[model samples]
Target: MITSPDNDNNRDEPMVFIVIAKAYETEGGQPIDLHVMLTAPDDDTAVRLTLNALSEEGFLEADLDQIGMITGAPDEEPHASAYQGALEGEVAIIRFA
Candidate 1:
């Protein structure tokens, strides 16, 4: 769970991001769609781990999105290293060494 180092210091750490998925059914009436939101760690490592766990459990469509480099404010606030890797050949592969 790639959490901020201050997770113990502060009780307001954001550990997970929400992902919304849905399924729809249509009959002679109005179409009804069922929506589900899943919460998982926002970092790459936890995302990969969760995906792998789901894959092992037979879930195939769940995947991760890459949001390249981010620009942060030039203040004294502490920051952490980001997940390293490129989205090679359309696959969001994260590498940690």
Candidate 2:
């Protein structure tokens, strides 16, 4: 669901990673859930990219809870949009505030 940074993969493919995170827009503000979707070769890269995206989105702090790979296209609203964005080399975040 996401594009690889180098545009290459060992098997000519990258994995879609969904990072579940609790993020704060401002210091001491209420946390919101961010489902960050991206593509990377490995989990490490996924986590790093997800964090970086969150930071760029103005999240001051983030608590990463889980990282999972999505093998199929999501059939819902935010997930569907996020997945589509990820495939286009964008870190798509579904925010639940």
Candidate 3:
């Protein structure tokens, strides 16, 4: 994950990620729940961190909420590799695991 700004001019950009996990009963019954809500310096880092933490804790299934520019597109939805990279950093969630 690139911690600092992409450009020479340092600007602190923030990204948010939400993690949702299901609550279960003793016999493995189901009751869905929003497990955690976290904000990281970037979305890739946030999702990657959340997945790693949950996986280490032995959670099988979870949902990821990626907001802001992290969804790989902006308001206009431009089809450019550089544009996508500019919006979302070059961090892949699976790599953390």
How does each model score on lDDT? Answer: 0.31, 0.88, 0.45
lDDT of 2 at 55: 92
lDDT of 3 by residue, 1-97 (tens): 9886578534455343444445332345454454343445665766667666655655565555434444333344222432344336432222111
Comparing 2 and 3 on TM-score, the stronger one: 2
What residue runs in model 2 are displaced by over 4 Å at the alpha carbon? Answer: 1-12
Best by TM-score: 2
As for candidate 1, its clashing pairs are: none
Q: Cα RMSD for candidate 1?
A: 15.6
Q: On a 0 to 100 scale, what is the lDDT of residue 8 in model 3?
A: 56
The 10-residue segment of model 3 with minimum total lDDT is 88-97
How many clashes does the backbone of model 2 have?
0
Candidate 1 residue lDDT tens string, 1-97: 9665745434343333222222122233332221111223344654555455445544445434332222332233211111111111111222221
Per-residue lDDT of 67 in model 1:
23
**Model 2 lDDT per residue over 1-97, tens place:** 6675654445544578999999999999999988999988789999999889899989999999999999888999889988888888889999996
Please give the TM-score that candidate 2 achieves against the real structure: 0.85
Sort by TM-score, top down from the best: 2, 3, 1
Best candidate, lDDT: 2
